[model samples]
Target: MTRARRKPMVAPKLFSEIDRYDEANSARLGLICIQERIPSGYTRWDREYNLDGRDARLTCISPGEYGGVPHGLDGDFATLLNVLYLEQGSPESGEVHTTAYQLIQRAGFPDSGQYYQSLQESLDRLKGATYTASESWRDHRQKRWTTVKFNIIEQIDSDTEGGTAFGVGTTLKIRLARPVVQSLRERYVKPLDLTFVMSLKRSLTRSLYRMLDAHRYDPANPQEPAAALRLPLLQWARECKLVEEVPARVRRNLESAHAELIDRGYLKSVTYEGRRAETIIVYEFGDLPATAPAPEPMIEVVPDSPVTEALRRRGVAHPVARRLVADFGENHVTVRLETFEAMIAAGYKARNPSALLVDVIKDQEGKYAALGTSALPAAVAPHARISKVVGDEDVDALSATLDTEFRALPPAEQAARAVTSVRMFIGKELREGHYRSLLRAVQAGDVDALELQREATRAAAELRLPEFAEGLRRAYSEP
Candidate 1:
């Protein structure tokens, strides 16, 4: 078998925005679904219960030869689903395009052979698993609780024009199920702060975050996202597919996950309403941080009519706009909108303009921020992207640009940024002091741009990266 090549790791861009639909509630494959290995003959998962006094049933079955429904690691497919929706452009958009490696990076997993194989397996399980939500699912289009059957992904095919997942140059064409597409058309089914969700340490915590966020947020009133949610403990366990009904067992199962979320600031507290199986788990959300914990809360639910309207004018739904302004403030939301608009004007084709706009507002990639005049690099070119090298001239040009940018900063600030930047690319602390000196040498003209690039590239190769020059260049960029 041919070994899959390693792609260089550039700094992860902030532009990776992910969203999901509420219609697919209770169908969390890996998060809430079984985590154990599936038996060869396994084929289905079914449960019947009451959801808010309504009869609810959930059924997921494997339509393909692949068995046991989408369980275990298939949970990570949530990342792929959000990416698909972010790029889907429209509920009517039958398909979206992405790559295996892109999904892997967004998943925050290491870029290695094992993960590539894991990605492929996850995709197969997701494509094969068909979920049937009976009253448990919401049909936003019809505005009613109804029985709905759909696959999170209707089909997955290798893009003829693009490489498949196992190869270096790969793109996957994913057909979205009709229901999912319909949900995408809505103003806000549920847009996840995937950056925050993905940052969680456990799949269990990640799963809890998604389900709870979906509950706390009310799409119709974006200005006031729900801050608290309460659910029957046993019902919640059943909803999460945690088979244990004993209150003690359920609480024990959730104990660590709840603690992790609280410590991470995603949850302020988790309280119980009763003892034993009769208990009701009450959860309150913490105030949104922009991303992680910035000094100025990056994301907070503030009400702003003007900003919300601006988003609406740009084809963003009233609710989504409100949600944007509510979660992220007016300034951040407006700048990103203007930037995306400017990029479109500059002939940047967007499959989903609204979705892209939503993505950009919350930590967009620097490359996409060019059209806006908001202290962003006028034109931060991708001089050395993953797996590719630039000419000596390109490297020299980047160095010159960095020099000019550096001169404008105070000496102390420049030194601070340089140290921080160099440390990130070095990957290991053992080499930190050496790289600091090396970075100073380049800044002070003791080293040329090409040599520094090669040195960094060689170091990257030691870590199994094919072309790590991207890291060397990206290290200097602070965004």
Candidate 2:
């Protein structure tokens, strides 16, 4: 007899304190590693600040072993938090037992080798990491910042006895530290869109997105549909884990990451104000538009046409084909059909042809350009306008390398080149906005243009794009 196929398991939604809009866990959480790559060995961070007239101290210790602290709490760790919290029925619960496959599925990760590997890594980091916070009130409560210590996960008990394919049976018994559990039990968590969080490509962008999303205006309160967060440059830098002491470098790094958030539609706009001693950054949250209802299916039966036949042959539904022909003129339909056929011939898969065709018609010219193709008439040479040039993919790859390259430059040269590299990589509109924001930071005495320029020259040499780098250098060097 054939063995019964195991039914697929469904994971539940994950939650976190950072998911909500609250000041408590706002500045000092050591949960995310803001760097591009995990640093080797244990990393420790400590800071002291005054919030709402109360003095506070925050300290985080990331163990060297177990892959260091997590890159951020959004992706895998967020999923793990959800799984553990849900299993215990309360965040304050000390310990719980579960299997690796259960956590992976619950976290919404694929049951694959790579995902399992990542799950193990997150578990290791969580078990080893620790956080502490101390606060003293100004109203005669305490003079110095008092401290309380806690671990994210106090301990992990693993069992790998039942051998299964891909190590799926590895069981984990986890104990969450009391302080973290209490914070969660007290409703210090924010509700977030896990799908949107996962969609963000960069960790910094993801963290910033969550912060802004937490501050989004509640629809129930018509008087205030949105909220604005004003963060001082130094504090912002500390919170973002961008730089330790330099405000100018912090501004440069923030503006670059902010551009990505704006492009992804997570932010509406970012403004900056320079003061004599500090720069202030203002973040504005945009309203997420309600998704429009699907269009009514087309009912008309059109006359026999090549476009209709072509669409039908390509598995486009009859109603969708009719709608395309009716909505878009015959010529537009014909061109898109040809392009779609070309893409198919070139091994491109149109997973949702109906939606893809709609997008294709809407941005016809840009779509062709984006696809690295030219829309030429059948009479003209088809490959005439298909010139060899750098594509977006190449630019994206270069952009990632640019950060590492910029960091390698001398400290004096880093700020300026960082700004220049951002301008070159992002779109024209976004670049302009970023420059304006930087100028605000500069005028407020938060950043120095001369320093930025000095760094740009060194960065240019490193990039080996002297012309482009020098052009930017000159622009900054000039009045």
Candidate 3:
């Protein structure tokens, strides 16, 4: 007699599938994810490299207020900007429309109101960062080197008011920087395997994978991805923006990322050659036993892990499963799985079973807090989460970063950029008339653009989601 297949002991997930994203030009800079952690009190970074036989330099300045230079989640948000740009029909520049909740879900962040605050924080940082490329900025369209300075994101407009959190459907408009557009128009890009990239837990691994992609994958023959990559150790460290330049320390820094990538099959082996800074790190891609498949549109290039398999069994997509497991730990995820299954056994019907499962795992806003049949250990409590306040500093930090960058721009460009901001006042809020006139001075190149952008940028971030409003109120109620 044939036995029935085992029922999946998990609930279904509800999320729209995001296609693979096209990323261009980031590979050339390779400074976005230099170090996993930016050193405290660090606000400026400068590095010199040779480009096309000419000396070039990259300098990034971040105000100490806006969480230092655009590091960590800043880079991830940059990648997501690319993804969202492509997802929102074809715009390499100009505005791509989206909502905050959609960004969180598509980026595989847990569905929670608290994340809405973090989302805005990352967005603010991206806009706050100023990158100066002295002859290092590759004009891909012109096929020559050029000097330029710009923020990661050009502009932001959102349906926000009253310095509060936004709701799920709050619309947002984000414009891409010109250099990014030029690269895309010139086809200096590759389809990033986000499925694989997002699966890797640490940002270091993700950064390494992207940088290596730049080294291994050629856009001309995008199908034939190279299987090997070799680079000098200390040079690679510099390229990665590692805080510590010492060889041993660099290796120690990359130890975990290297291990994760190898375990995930992005690399079969990573071996070093020679001595000191000149030591060459060689990477062999894929598994020895299995021949690697040609790069696909959304190629994962990874074997299924047990946690991923478990999540997949519950109807979560492969990439999403890995992302969820990576975002939340595997150890406690299994418990979430069991809790979800228990709900199913108890006849708790769900419109989106997988979403319910994830919500249970995330203990999103304590919605499923009381559903626990048995209380988990303090270390394993799913509902337990740290609620970090979006303090005054977080709100006020980027004003300096935005102000300094605007002032640094030449009069002509600054006026042009300001006019762009002024045009956004077309059909906004109650302050449309008053604010439009205020920023119109900047648009006319009369007054400073700092005050207007500072307020506008802060407004964009201020829309607190209804779920977290009470918590925010309580926090602000203190002192």
Tell me the TM-score of each prediction against the true structure: 0.56, 0.46, 0.56
Which residue ranges in model 1 land beyond 4 Å of their true spot?
A: 1-42, 49-53, 63-67, 159-168, 218-227, 243-246, 271-275, 288-479
- For model 3, residues 49-102, the per-residue Cα lDDT tens digits are 876677989998877777777666566667877765543333333455566656
User: What overall lDDT goes with each candidate model?
Assistant: 0.53, 0.48, 0.58
lDDT of 1 by residue, 1-479 (tens): 43444333222122122223333343332223533344655577677866568787877777546655665556656555654554433424556555555666667666576776776777777777788878765555566666778776778854221234453223455776776666555533444555666666666766766666655544333223465788899878766666456889888888888998787766789999878867999997775444553221112233447777676666665445655676766665655566565556655444455655665565322223222233223331221121022334544565567567656643323333333333323434324334445445554655554444334323322332223434444444322
lDDT of 3: 0.58
Q: Which candidate is the best by lDDT?
A: 3
Candidate closer to the true structure by lDDT (higher is better), 2 or 3: 3
Query: What is the lDDT, from 0 to 100, of the residue 272 in candidate 3?
Result: 92
**Which regions of candidate 2 deviate over 4 angstroms?**
1-30, 67-70, 73-75, 82-84, 105-112, 136-146, 161-166, 213-226, 243-245, 251-257, 275-277, 288-479
In model 2, the worst 10-residue window by lDDT is 12-21
Clashing pairs for model 2 are 17-189, 19-190, 20-190, 41-64, 42-64, 274-444, 413-455, 416-452
lDDT of 2 by residue, 198-282 (tens): 5555556666665455434331221122435787877766655443448666666656668876766556789889863478888
What's the lDDT for residue 360 in model 2? Answer: 46
